[model samples]
Each structure stands twice: as C-alpha cells, then as structure tokens.
Target: MKPNAAATAAALHYTIVPKDLAGHIFEVTLQIAAPAADGQVVSLPAWIPGSYLVRDFARHIVQIRASSGGKKLALKKLDKHSWQAAPCRAELTLTYQVYAWDLSVRAAHLDASHAFFNGSSVFLRAHGQEDQAHVLEILRPANVAGKSWRVATSLPELKAKRYGFGSYVAADYDELIDHPVECGDFLLATFEAHGVPHDFVINGKVPNLDIDRIVADLKPICEAQIALFEPRTKTAPMQRYVFMTMVVGDGYGGLEHRASTALICNRNDLPLTHQSEMSDGYRSFLGLCSHEYFHTWNVKRIKPAVFVDYDLRLENYTSLLWVFEGFTSYYDDLMLVRSGVIDEAAYFKLLAKTINTVTRGSGRFKQTVAESSFDAWTKYYRQDENSPNAIVSYYTKGSLVALALDLLLRTESAGKKSLDDVMRALWQKYGRDFYTRSTARQGLGEHEIAALIQGATGVDVARFLAKYVYGTADVPLAQLYAGFGMALDGAQASKASLGVKASRDAGDCKLAYVYEGRAAHLAGLSAQDVLIAINGLRVTAADVADGLHSAVGRYRIGETVELHAFRRDELLVVRAKLQADDMPALSFTVLEQAALLRPSWKKTTRR
Candidate 1:
C-alpha cells in the first residue's frame, strides 16, 4: 500500500526575517527533518518556470552555513547554486542571507518601506526530499515597529491569520515555491468568485482607487473562466486566489502561478474613483490581467510536456508556446467582449491592432512561430534595437495562428465546434486529473497537437499548422474576415516615410530602429542618428516627423531627397529615393454586417 502523503511526509521548516531593511537583505533559517547518510547537498534553482532563461538565483546568496545537533558542520560550495555539508546523523539546520534587489514580477525586491519575494529566490530545495511537506514562518521585521505591516500570499495558512505574520504550509517543495509573498503597508480588498475567496492586494500608491470598479470588472471574468473549465460544477481548481499588483509610475507586465498572479502597472492605468469612460491604458492593463489569469489553466496547469516537471538547471525547450502562450493571447482580449466588459466592435479594433503590429515587422517572413518559441531564451528575452528586423514574437503571431484555427474549426463544423470546444477537450483529456492524482502528470507535446485536434473535432488541421505555425506563411485574414460579414479595407493611400521608427529625444528626432532594405537603411541612416535638417531646412525632434514628411510630400515614389543627421557627435548627409512600402494597415468595417445577427458558419469569403 502507498504511504499517505500527509502522514508519511517529513516536514521542512523555514523561518524568514527582514534582517536589514535598509540594505535589502533577508535572513533565512531552514531546518531539515533528516540528513543524508552521505553528505547532504542542497541547491537553488537556476531559473523559474513561465519565464525562460537561467537566472542564477544562488548569486544573491551573501552568506550561508550548516549545522546539526548543536554542532556546526563543514559546508563546501559545489558549483554555482549547490552546497554540500559533511555527514550528520541528526536533523540539519542551514542559515543564509539573500540580497533582494530585483524589482520585477520574476524575482525578489525589498526596500525600507516594502518587502516581497518569490520562493525561487529564497528557498533551497533539499535533494531527494522534494516530495516532503514544507512550512514557512514569516516573522515581523526587526527594523520596523508597529507599522501596520501585513503579509499577503496564496500559500495555505497553518497557524496564521489570513493576512498576518505567522506560519504557512505547502504540500511539497514545488507547491511552496509557486506562491510569492508580499509584505508592506498595502491596500487590501476582498471579493468572492463562485463562493471562492479572492484577495486583491495593491502595493503602490494609486490615489482614490476605484476598488468597486476593479471588483465588478474582474468578477465576471473570474466567473466565466470557472464556468468554462468546470461547467457542471461551476468551480475553480484553487481554494483561494490572489491578484497581487505593484503600481508604479510607468511599468506593465505580469507572471502567473497556481492560484495567484503578480502584476506591475502604471498608476495612470488604474481606474479612478468615478471614471466613466475607459482609457486606453486601463484597457491595456485589463488585457495584461486577462492574459496572466488565463495562464491559470493554459501554461500553469496545461503545460508543455517539457515543463510538466521543470528542469530548472537548464533551458527547457518546447515548440508548443503557440498553444500555451499564443492561445491565451488570443483569448485574453476576446474574453473581455464575451464577458460583457467590451463590445464586439472594440474587440475587432483590438484584433486590427494586433494584426497591424504583427505585419508591420519584417521578421514575420523570416522566422516561423515554432522557431521563435524554440529560440525564446536567447532571442526574445534578450531583444535589442534590431529585434524587429531579425526575429518575430511568438506571442503576437501565435495569436494569429489561434485565430485562424478558430475560424477554420467554426467554419468546418458549421459553428458547432469552436476553439472553445478544443480547449474544453484539452482540459478534460490532459488537465482535469493533473493535480488531483500524481499518476496523470501529462503535458501536451509538439507531435500531439494535430492528432488531438483531429480526434477532438473530426477536422484535420495538419495543413493549417504546417502553413502558419511551422512555416512562415501568413494566415488568410482577409478571406476569413469576409466569412463573418466583415470587410478588410486595405489602405490605398500611403504616408510619407523615412522607413524608420523615430522618437523625440532631447529636442532631437532620434531613430530608434531603421528597417532593413528601407530608404533609411539604403541612405546609411543608422539607429541613434539624430536628425537636424531635411533638404537644408532646420528641424527639431518635435516637428521632425511633420517636417520630414512635408519635405518629401511632393516627391513621388522613386523620387530622391537629401537628409542631414548626426550619428553621435559626427554629422553626415545622404540622399535616397522613396520606395512604395506596403504599410500593414488593415481597416475592418461592416459589409453585410447588418446581418451580424443570426450569422452562420456555412459561408465562404465573398469572391
């Protein structure tokens, strides 16, 4: 008979304290239940999942030591993140100090006012004892006294209040590391989704925040996702969920977890106390939230095969980000419309924005989505100024692939089968019993997609995947949009261009990125060039865009114009002819949209 997980598990206890708040250091003490007969080896993870690349977390360890049975044991460093201790018969104890300074969703950060950390940044995994239960004790900061400080996290409480300084428990090492903790004088609010409690914890200053609006806007989204996965029961997989946001002057992104998400957004992106109209920034923030929340099912649980058991020591490569991240990107904004927060017209506009962004870059023709996903660690995460000219984003183009598949499935099955069906099929087949039973720890592989789609929907999508996902062929958007009573109005009028993306910098127009094979590239106009004149006319950054466009306004295609710019302190002049560029500007309008009501899928593009 198998030993019970709760009863047979050895407990690993950890005590954490804000040792030096001004210096941003955390003092940690880990008590091991037992030590190895041989010397025990402990290692910190080289990287965290969801975000690719090796972070070398152990580099933050400032000091470390090991002891057992009240006697200090000799500790030796074994490589980067691993440490070995001499043989000990009694329970072992390890103490360390970590320097916390990174202020992003990926790592740990601490200041005099606030403290936050991910388990990957502080906890060291005990080799060969990963399945044992782990417990953490959060102590009140020694430096600060009576500051109304509170702890917020999704980790289960043992002898702690909901948001107090005390003990928390995790099923194992993996579960323990998945929940990030934030302690500060935060703004806290609570709401219930399908009777499950969700805590909203904000760590920055947003003046007169409209908490009701946030609760109202996010509640429907949470409920809809719950109903999507567990339709009959209307239940969520998590017992509790937390949305931990850090508001700043200007920042935006998020990272997902099992039952919680960490987000960073600009202060202006938050809705005010009585704001009626939705600003573009607020919409973008909502999209970011939706994207990360969708990962609760897509990437966090329904993971790529290689990620089922993450090998944190190295890069875990998979070509299925088109399904993991791409599909979630496609649904992030679409769910807003379906959930009644946004309208269909607004959704179509959002879709057009994505389409324009993807097509504007020249790299879509050079790199496939699969290649982009595979090289994400080296290329996407470490992008530079020439990124658009060399590589494509799996997130952007991958969403288009998902859109194409949704259209294909809906059209082929007469509106009876949509991407919704495919997702439900994915959950039922692979994700339903994932955490409930350890034996069914399965993830989707690259070779399994075509067969799975065919088996679930009785439609063969091998050619579709080959043309768009694995190959660099663009999806037939114009043809597909027409099938839904939408007209793709490709722009005929062109805008005057230097074939470069420039921004106003220090009263001068600076080229941010010069497209390859464009007029700017041919004229030797490099990125970082500051434009001062066009055809002997003075120009400043504020008016350079209009000035340069007006300077070449009268010139037709194939016409040449002179330009002056400074690359660093040196000045140069170059002449280049205008080229007819197919600006990726598509406008979607209503054609037979009058009949938007009661539309059928058994319709082809208006040929």
Candidate 2:
C-alpha cells in the first residue's frame, strides 16, 4: 500500500490574513479523524495533483500541533510530512502556518500585501477513509477593512457573507484534492459566451494592459470549442469556467483545473495591435494561456486510465501524454488561427518553429513519445545539461505526432473527416452533465478515449503506441509530414563558411554551439568564446542572425558583407560573402488542385 493510501479529510478551514504580520501570513487548519489503527500515521502531500514530483511540503510547515477531543496529543515526526500521534480515541485537529513571500502560483507565500496557497502546502489529508465528505472555510483579516476581494476556486462557492469567502463542500477526498483554492485582493471580471459564465479573478490594480481586448480575442477560441462539442451533446458537464491570473511579473505559466485555471503572467500577453512588434516573451505567454485553457476538455475530463485515478504517493505512468498533452499543444496554436486570432502565414510560421525544434532535438532519436511520458517523473521533470542529448520531451514530440496523425486522417479520409471529430466523439462518450450528477464519485478512464480513437482512426494505434510510445524508437517524421502537405527537408551541414551557430548564451554574447566544417569553423571560431563585437558593432548572440540578415536584407541577391567576431579570445575580422541561401530553410507550399478542397480528413493536396 502507498504511504498515504487510506488518507482522508473530514473538514478544512482556511483564513486569509492580509495584515497578520505587517500584512503577511495565511493561517490554515485541518480537522480530521484518527486512523483506525493506533500505530498508523497521517501526512500532507509533498506535491499537488496535475504537477507530479514531491515538493516536501513539510519544509513550509512552520508550526504543527495535533490534538484529540479537548486534550492535546503529543505528535512526533516519523519522517517528513508524516507524524506519529499520541494515544487518542477522539477527533483530531492540525493547525499550521505557511509563509507567503513569493508571488508565484505553484507555492504558498505571505507578505505585507496578500496571500496565495497551492493547497498541497497547507491542506492535510486524513490518514485513512478518503471517501468521507469534506468542507473548507475561509476567513479574512478583520482589521483591514475594505470591500471583499473576489473569491475564486474550482470548487463551488457557498453563499456566505462574514469571512469574505464561505465554505466549499467536497463529496470525498478525491474531489477535495482536485479543487485548489486561491483568495486575495483582486479585480473580478466576468464575460458570458454560449450562455456559460466565465470569470477572471485577477491580482494587482486596474490592469494597465487591455483587459476587454484580451477577453474579446479569446471569445472565438472558446466559442469554437463549445460549438464543436455541444453539437455532439447539448448539455455539457461544466457550469462555471474560471480563469485566475497575476499580472505583475514577466515570467508566467498556468495550471489547468476542471472548471477553472490559475495563470501567472506578464502584461505583454495582452493582444496589442502591433503584434509583430511585440517581444517573443509575449508570444510565448499567449501560447501557454491557450494551451492550459484547452486542457479543460482534453486533459481535465477526457483523461488516460493511468491518470484517471491519480496515485498521490508516486508517479502515475501514462503512454498517452503524447495524445493528451501533445494533441492539446498542437491545437493551442491552431485554435489561434481557427479563431482568427492569427493568419495562415502566422500559423505556418508557428508550425515551422515546432518543426525546427523537433528536427534539432537530439533526444528524438533516443526516446519515443511513450517512453518520454512514462519516464516523465525521472527524466522529463528533472531536466539537466545532458537532457538535450538523452531525453525527448513528450510535450514537443507528442505535438508533432498529433500533427502527423491529423494530417494522415485528412489524407486517408479524402477530406471527409478530421481530428476534430475524434475530440467530439470522446466528449459525447464521457462528458455528460457533470453538475446534475456527481463526477466526484465517477473518476474518468483513459482507455475509453483510446478505444474510441482506435475505432475512429482505423489504425491499430494501440500497437503503434506500444512500439513508439513504450519503446525508444524515433517517430517516422519524414513519412508523417508527407501526407499533411508538409515535409522536413532533412538537416544538411550548413555552408555558412562558419562552423558555429551563435546565439545569446546565458545573458552574454558567445558562441552558443558549433558544427564541424562550417565557414565559422574554416574562419577558426570555437565554442565558449565570448563574442564581444561583430562587424565593428558590439554584438550578442541575439543580434548575430538578425544582424546578419539585416546586412543582406537590403541588398539584391549575390550581396557580400564582412563579418567580425571575437574568436580565440581575440578580436578577429572575417569576410563572409553572402549567397542566396536555401540550405537551412524548411518550406511548405500549397499545391494547386482542380477544385477547392476544404480542410478535412480525405482530400489530397496536389501542390
């Protein structure tokens, strides 16, 4: 049995103190029953759901005191997060404090301003009997008087007024763990689409960024998903879809929830008119938001069997991460185009970037998508220097695999069907009215979706999955792209007269990487050499390609330019003649067909 196999919780009470310690600290209390066995132990989870890997939540447990009936029981630490309780025959309570200093989404912190908790750090599970119903109550600072800041969570909010936010009821331990609660001073924004309520609980002041514009832009993506799925079944399970985010910092990402998601992001993610002029960070931020939101349907509900009933003690292996995470990745950007957020050229540009990434990664040759997903605990989650050489990313390869399968379906079906149909089919079979009944009691099964895809796609996908997913064989990229009207013109040694690919490495201008027999090599450039300046202009790795491109962008074909570099710890000038280069380019063109063909599964492209 797992360490906390029979862990359960009867009730949880949380209070947000905005000014507890000069406006820092959030107090949390857990009420649980003593396990049946006298020698048994209770503990907190080292990590939360969705995000695998132990965080040693005990490190943040500042004070922990256990008591039974009306008398205090002496608790002794057996190990991190687990404690041996003194002899007791009555109910017990555990109270602890979590430091809220960091303003990030994944952990708990407290400061002079607000509080954030990730549930894993503060909520305790009853050692046995997880099926028992649970409740959570939240309290705000009494002295700090102001209109109640918005309360948001995936769990249903009870109608109560005194403590800013009321209690949440969970059918059992599984439901309690699935829903994460976050409360702080924030701006609450609401929008409606398809008659479903969408709420945004945002932190910080009136966003200097355009809030309404961001909502308007995401409308189509949401509408398209609803339109496709609702056609299969009119009444879906979801009622309130909440999106929570912090608007202060530059680095950002998100975690998906059943009816809501929490995102940590920057201001630039807002869609601006001069989008091209926006920084690369902004573009990547939008991609993350799109990815997490898509998970509501694909991952949160339609899940793999391995993930259906999560084992909180250790890693739960699933070969279908490529299907779950990767397919979602493929759609994150495509939805942008389908929703008219971007144009075809922009869409291809994004696809081209993924192509470049997959082609360049060395791990693709070593690990298959299935292995990547299964070994995610040891390999994917804990990335190191050698990761580039030994391990493939399930997320990246999975996305490409999803793309290949979609194109194959399109080509084989003669433009009559699509991957979209596969998604709709899964929803119809699994996603019934979640609110009417209790999804709390009925956890999802992954095999159901897998079985549906096998019947729909007509490929013994299970066998293919067993091989490429379970085994470390390289995916047949060359074959997969052909049917999709795309191709991977295999990488050839560049003739740039330089052997090195220069890029900004760790905030400094340096030789990022080197390939043998290139012009930079012939010119005598070695790796790790700082490139202080190029062509008499002080340069970093970021400016190398663009700077090189700009020098040739203005001139007609056959233009020549002199390049200077800091080579061999010395400033050296090397002259590189420009050539109309097609060697490094990955190109896709539309083939002319006799008649207009719509995007579908069967129609073949002539171009």
The candidate that wins on TM-score is 1
Ten contiguous residues minimizing lDDT sum, candidate 2: 1-10
- For model 1, how does the per-residue alpha-carbon lDDT over 1-607 read when each residue is reduced to its tens digit? 1224563356888999888888989999998878787888899999888888789999999999999999999999999999999999899999999999988898899887788999999999888888888889999897644268999999988889989999888877898899999998989888998999988889988888987788788887787777777878987878899999999998988999998999999999999987888888888888888888889888888878888898877899998888988999998887776676776677778888899889888888898999999988998888877888888889999999998888788778767777777888888877777777758598998789898898878889999999999899889978876677778777864655667777778788888888888888998898889877777877665465553566555567788878899988999989977766545778788765312212234443432
lDDT of 2 by residue, 236-296 (tens): 3467677777766475878787777778876656545534343455556667767887888
Residue 552 error, candidate 1, Å? 7.1
List TM-scores for all candidates, in order. 0.93, 0.78
Superposed on all Cα atoms, the candidates' RMSDs to the truth, in angstroms, are 3.6, 6.4
Alpha-carbon runs more than 4 Å astray in model 1? 1-9, 504-508, 537-559, 579-583, 592-607
**Which 10 consecutive positions of candidate 1 have the poorest summed lDDT?**
593-602
Alpha carbon lDDT of each predicted model: 0.83, 0.61
Query: Model 1, residue 225: what's the lDDT?
Result: 79
User: Which model scores highest in lDDT?
Assistant: 1
